[model samples]
Target: MEIYNDHKKLFTAALCLFLLLTFFVAIGPAFTSQNNNAPLPGSKPLSSLQTEGKAVFIAEGCVACHTQQVRNVEMDKVWGPRPNVAADYANITRTDVWRNTATLMGSERTGPDLTNIGTRQPGDDWHYLHLFNPRSVVSQSVMPSYEWLFDIKDYAWPNDVVVNVPDDFKKGISGKIVASHKAMALVAYLKSLKEVTLPDGKPVPLFLYGKTAAEKAGGATSKGAGTKSGPDGEALYATNCQSCHQGNGEGLVGAFPALKGSKVVLDDNAELQVTIIMKGYNGRVSEGYGEMPPVGTNNNLKPEEVAAIVNHERSSWGNNSKKVTVDDVKKIIASFDKPASVAAKK
Candidate 1:
């Protein structure tokens, strides 16, 4: 009766209840999650450059179109090796003392999910060129060019890393495009977004309604997209090498060399082919094409992964060549003293 009748008493009780409710509903769960969850194994905290890049990623409004998360679904399998667990984002924190974007798990997915982009596209050359002009690589890309992140230099300095944008898409700009510090930072951040491998023998949650799940349930299902031997070469090619070498294997003129009917690709001996992939190729720079970064090395790819990519190119697009095994590629790699490139002789 006193609580109801007395204004002071009613206010006090309501305030206490509200505080208790908030602590129990919001604060309690958050603290519990923080204690229980940890960042995934092998997920490193951002490097200095990567941190700077993340700031650019946020400031440039990349959060509006792209998403950091890969949902637990069949389609999302393309975005990551496995569905995201709470541990995947355990390290994310508030932006600052006053602001937080809550891990930037954005709502709209206007662009491809970036969860595994690091593993898919690890090289910086393509990224730099693509950032300067989205249409340069992806003809139908609706993403706006991040030209502010580059400098148009009439004569690039010896130490400068210049981007080789295609002639057609250059829009009559005479100067060479050089990546600015912000662009370098942003690419570093983008290149850091790889999913960590789960511990051994731990059952991965099957992508829902997907072939893995269906097969596990003893239901009739189409074969999974993976190749019978190892990794799916076609999928690897699509993710890793497709940007420069167009889908049909006709590379962009004056940018990337065409793979279609290339003698190196068709050659039965895969020595030069494997070398070019393992070590970055710059021999063609004299002929207007851009230098290719050592994709296999940059991504820390396994021998099987490189072999798969090699096999894909050799067998695809009317270029029929005998596929080389992982062991064969490994032997070639062992001959080299680490992963520095050699001048590829065509």
Candidate 2:
């Protein structure tokens, strides 16, 4: 009884309780979340370029100003479709044995949550310009320039990646500002930060409060009643195309090509457009438009979804073209072997 009442014994007991509460009660569930065990449905491992860029991002302390996390608060709706869940970041792997900077879910919104940047503002030119001079694209931006990642080459080589800067932002620097390999890698990493949609029936953080049950119940309506009205095309475009190509199909100048009144878009035959979307476009092919990294192959876009995007692009922006069906897109996709012949057709 004396030992139990002693100050030393009581102090030891309190210390043990504190440790248990800290480790087990407060922190244990976070480490044991089920979502951490598996990658989200559309999650993919970062490529070599993206990995290097991630290192630059961390090395530069980008996380100090920007956050990768989207909270469940109504104010955070601008960041992503839904508040972030553990599954959203499940696929991020450690950079190496010594570094584990893969999970860069920052807590500050000094910039913005980059969770869906790939689907929001995904153009090499725009990213480069933003890095070179933040105010060029966003007048209110306070972010510093990462000009060291770029090179002001006297003349660009045939295969060099050039950063297209507007005349106003250009400070009379005599040559083209070509992006170094590091800049490309950093852009790749930023572009790879898109959010993968949670699988059906999975519960997401409730940004729309008091509507969880209603949302689950309304899932049936998302199926659509018929073919033309189906959510596939518009939904797919919103997910894959809307970022670089603006919501109105008028893409950013010097960055992404405009779909409105574009010769390729207005062409009766959809083969070339389909091919470009599937295989990607090299910037060297055109003088103005920047390189469009292949969207279909890496993203695993299905034939039907590609067709949907094609139809959406063609039909929108005052374009009066016949709606190309999935069957039509499938034929073009199948003819990948005969590129010379496929591209030859007008």
Candidate 3:
């Protein structure tokens, strides 16, 4: 009894038991469950560029502020189409080379969740601008600018992809600021962080893992509000387009062209507008606004959603032009061979 009750022996036994409990109850289950889960239907492994970008993401400590996981909660509906599940990350494993950690499921959300940033905001210009200077796009963003990942080029060659920074953000540098290879890779990695959606009626549902209090009250509904029906035009525009084009339809001066009172919005025909929105435009429509990538292509927007967005633009800002129907958008999309410049001709 004296030996069994010795303070050192008792302490050692308790410590060993604690370690065993932690392994079996916490660590062991996590590894077992992760290995057991099948890869979700649409989950794609990160490409080489994306893998390097993921390395950059880790090196930059982006995980400290942004969380990758989207909890099954009512408030989290704003971040993604559905709650994230363990199976969503089933394919993430150790790499043979470098053997860096694959899981980036962060805990803090000082920044917004990025599980669906690729689908939500895929604009290259916006991302470049934001990375160069967060406050340039988001007036009150607390995020620090990653200006180190860019280079000031005195003269851009024909093929050099120069980041188009507005004159206001250009801090007296005469040269154009272009994204470095690392910056491009990082952007690619960020854009690759898409949410995985499993096929319906799979053996196990992802929603079963992360149910919020509100979701639990409603029998653990994981589906967010945006996926109920067809895409909501106002919501879609707000998420994808409104950053460049202001809320009032008046875009930034000399940066983004004003949608309000624009000739295209008030045009008799909606063909140009539809085409420009789908394919993108790179002409000097307004001073300093030289390039506009295909918004639809970036976001992978559907014809119906594009139709709704076009109709919204035409009707809003007191410009009561003809409302574009889905069929009209469908016809334009079917004739994808139309060159952007040819269709953009006003």
Cα lDDT of all candidates, in order? 0.81, 0.76, 0.76
Q: For residues 1-346, what per-residue lDDT tens digits would candidate 2 score against the true structure?
A: 7758799998898899999999887688768764457787779999988889998998889988888888888778767778887666777777789867658777677787788887665557779888987766665678888999999989899888887776677788778899898888999999998878778997766785444766545543211112633335666776676656767787666666788888878888888888888877774446766677667765667886787778777777797676677788888888877765575553
Worst-scoring 10-residue span by lDDT in model 3: 219-228
lDDT tens digits, residue span 205-314, model 3: 23434666675455411111123355566766677678788677887665678889999988867788877887777766445574777888766678877877877687
Task: Score every model by TM-score.
Answer: 0.77, 0.59, 0.71
Residue-wise C-alpha lDDT for candidate 1, range 83-142, written one tens digit per residue: 988888887766568976357788899989998888777767778878888887888899
Query: Clashes in candidate 2: how many?
Result: 0
Ranking of all predicted structures according to TM-score, beginning with the best and ending with the worst: 1, 3, 2
lDDT of 1: 0.81
Q: List the residue pairs that clash in candidate 1.
A: none
Q: Estimate the overall C-alpha local distance difference test score of candidate 2.
A: 0.76
